[model samples]
Target: MDLEVVEGLVTAIRPAANPTDDGAVLLPGLVDLHTHLREPGGEAQETLITGGAAAAAGGFTDVFAMANTEPVTDSVERVEWLRAHAPGDGAARIHPVAAITVGLDGDALTAMEALASAGVTLFSDDGRCVDRADLMREALHRAHRTGTVIAQHAQLADLAGNGQINAGRAARATGLPPWPASAEAAIIARDAVLAAETGGSLHVCHVSTAASVDVIRWAKSRGWPVTAEVTPHHLILTDASADSADPVNKVNPPLRGQDDVRSLRRALVDGTIDAIATDHAPHTRQSKQRPWIDAPFGMTGLETALGVVVRALLEEDALDWQLLARVMSTRPAQIGRLGPASGRLPQTGAVADFVLVEERSPVRVDPSRHLSRSKNSPFGGLELPCRVLRTVVGGRVAFEA
Candidate 1:
């Protein structure tokens, strides 16, 4: 398959003679509303080029980059630098999500209006919660006024103190600190109320607990402007899998219990959970190799996102492709305010971005083949039903097989 791009827009998709050689399905390009392109500092873990490649390989054409890097992205200058420095790889388009507060410090706020004028539609302090209710409310007010989104990491630091794993059996068995669901739920509940009252756009990042889902549902029922995302890892894995204390499973908002997993699935199916973000955190092996407690929390996710989703939701007959497109593409585009139809079919004579998913053959994941600098992927050795045959972003062949 060949995709032609001109001026960064897909001009034409020249098809292979046998386009459906392996029963490939053309999907609207996937959009990840949450991804960590660890650049400017964590180059050993990931860079713009490598992270973009990973997103292309995973069938994503657009990704909302989290602002948790060194010299956190909080200003228009940093945001402009990211936009101009995006690698010319024709891979996923990187949308900078600036931090909501200065340095993510939770005290002073960033120039939200100025950043929005610079074309940043989303703001977040994803690795930390805005613990101060007043600050959070002010940010929400600014967001409502600017029509932008404030994505929260949603963990109450005081409640989740020094926790290394979920507060279930896995925590007990590992003898590690417990990360209770209350820690995440409490923040979601507070933010939901703030969003409703202030009429601001609130996006909950990586909904890992059932309580979080319940709160989001209630917010929706109340007709509040709240949207939530669930990570591919959290939707499938459980805290039970964390018993080994393998740092690969260590993530913020920690993998949850079985009920949470089930609830997340149901929420996704029912539209209570809006998008399936990869939360594609890339951490170097030397760092991930540390004892679970001391290791930085993250895992490489871009390469394995689609396969995991297919195996967990599609293969299990829990969701169909249309709904999958909404969760992975359409809704994310809407929530992130990333102009219309990112993962949907481009109208004829319009520029396009999309992916061809080969579903007839199965393939096992291999961590060594990851394009990211980090090899901390959790899907290693697992065989799944689908592979991305190609990804065309803006009519260019970003990745092909």
Candidate 2:
């Protein structure tokens, strides 16, 4: 189909010849619910400029930037700083996620009402769980009243303390501390109840274990206002990385076994999981090159997320384009409360935020070619399907390959 753009709006849509000639598929630009732009503090790893470019390259139009920086995004001042410094219309829009707790300390809640008024639709203490039941309950209450969401990292620190890899055989083989699946599941279960009692929307970020899936499923069955997201890395990769002991595979809520990977896929397909989020954490090369036990946990995903998802779910016929749109775009947009133009289908008079994807050719993952400042992709050197041909944000071409 031919889409005509005028002044940043899609003016018309008409069928064109050979729409499938290049195996081209146009989709609403992807929306990422979880992304770490690393600005205002960690610019050595990434900034709004580099991170937004990477997000556009991955076919994303809008990304909710997490609140885990040096000073922490917990105030109206901090959020406005992010908004003022975000990239121009040529790049993906950055929606600032405010910290649920001051400095992400998890002891005291941030000013939720003030932050919401400042345009923060999501709150989180990501990289640190709000483990205090009193604080969690109070935050949920505020989120419910403000009509925003609380996105939890969901790991009990005591259970996950010093964990280097997934628990069980993988941890045993690597001689690293084991991270129990219960650490995640237990927190999800607790938070789900808090969400229900407080009548607030809860978003579980980076659900990694099969046990976590079961908890989310149960919560949804009970009609709680709960949603969950799974990362592409978690859906496609496994704890087999324990054998390689590569720090690139080291991530928070560390990669789990194949059984968990399969469960995450099934949950995504069956509507048990609402979205696919890239916890796009980036680290400096020096920080990432440290010894396994001392190195930071992260993997750059903004440039490779779409291909990883397509490779994980397409071949099995588990997801068609429409379903793909929901998990990758629409649902995430809803969760983040991004405006109407963010995740809409291609239509006349709509703002053009979309990507043209070439489905026939697969691209080999290369960290060096990525737009992100950091090169820490776990999928490096692997071939993946669906290359993004072009990304348009507000009718402006942000990236073309």
Candidate 3:
């Protein structure tokens, strides 16, 4: 196949018209709606530079960096610093999401207008939900005026406090406190109402339960402008694996039952879930090696996201490639409000940002091969069918396998 790169924009892509040709499976570069490139504070686990490199290797041409940093990205200066200083080599573009609350304390709202002026398109108090309903309502009202999206982590602190795993038979068998599915569903339900009332865009991050999916579907049916994402881990694994006591299997919004897993998969296939986001929350070995309850709630997902999604969903014919593109790239860009102007493949005059995949190649997931500072993955040693051969950002080769 012949591809023309015109001034860092993909000019054209068409069939070579040759039978024995190695045709490249061209896809719009993956855009991560959720990512934690721990910088400005948690550099011990990850930095913007290293995280950008890792994203490029993972075939991502753009990523939305969460604002749960040490000094929260609640100010315009910090957002500007992240956008300007973020590493770029035709690699992934890093767009910072400013915190919704000051210092992420859930007390006062951040300067949404100032941050929006600095080019921040999204706002969140991720890693922790803004539990105060009044505070969240006010933030949503302000965000609507600023044209910024409010992405909620979707967990009720009081209900989820000290909870480790999904509240189900599995947690009961293990004698652990349950992180009730209602904990997430309740917040989504409430947020959907708030978004409807405030006329704001609401996005739920890393939705884990079947009930939450229903809430999002209901909200969307009402034309409330709500979007939701599911993590790769939640799509592939479940709490049954948690019985082994391996911290790698542990994560916030902990793994749920097989029924919930099936529901999440169906949601992805049926458009109930807007996108598949890699909540690529990386933690150090020391942090991940702690007792299950004590370990930080996250795992490395960037490098393995596409492969796992393809294997668990596409490979099984649960979803087609077009749907994959929509869920992984197109819809995410739309939800993040980065669509037409940025975060899309060049269609004539558009910017060049995309990835080429060797769909038949096998994936051997290994920490040593990953570019992130931490090496914690539940998919370690799991072989997958699809492989990313090359990634292009702004018409430049960011990664080549």
Please report, in order, the local distance difference test score of every candidate based on alpha carbons: 0.87, 0.91, 0.87
Cα deviation of 15, candidate 1, in Å: 14
Instruction: Please give, for residues 1-401, the per-residue lDDT of candidate 3 as tens digits.
Output: 66677777767766565645456577888989899999989999999988888888888988999999978898988888887889866768899989999999999999898888878889999998989999989988987898889999999988888888888787887787888999999999999999999988888999999999889889989999789999999998989989877888888889998888889999898888989899999899998899887888898888889889988896447747788888989998888888585545457656677888878788789887888998998988999888888888877888888
What does candidate 2's lDDT look like per residue over 44-159, in tens digits? 99999999999999999899999998789999999999999999878998999999999998778999999999989999999989999999999999999999999999999888
Report the number of the highest-TM-score candidate. 2
Which parts of model 2 have CA positions greater than 4 angstroms off? Answer: 18-20
**Candidate 1 structure lDDT:** 0.87
Select the stronger candidate by lDDT from 1 and 2.
2
Candidate 3 global CA lDDT score: 0.87
TM-score of each: 0.95, 0.98, 0.96
- Candidate 1 segments exceeding 4 Å error: 1-22
| Candidate RMSDs in order | 2.4, 1.1, 1.6
lDDT of 1 by residue, 174-245 (tens): 999998999999999999999989999999999998888888999899999999998889877888778898
How far residue 143's Cα lies from its native spot in candidate 3, in Å, is: 1.7
- Candidate 3: worst-modelled 10 consecutive residues by lDDT: 15-24
Model 3 residue 109 CA deviation (Å) reads: 0.4
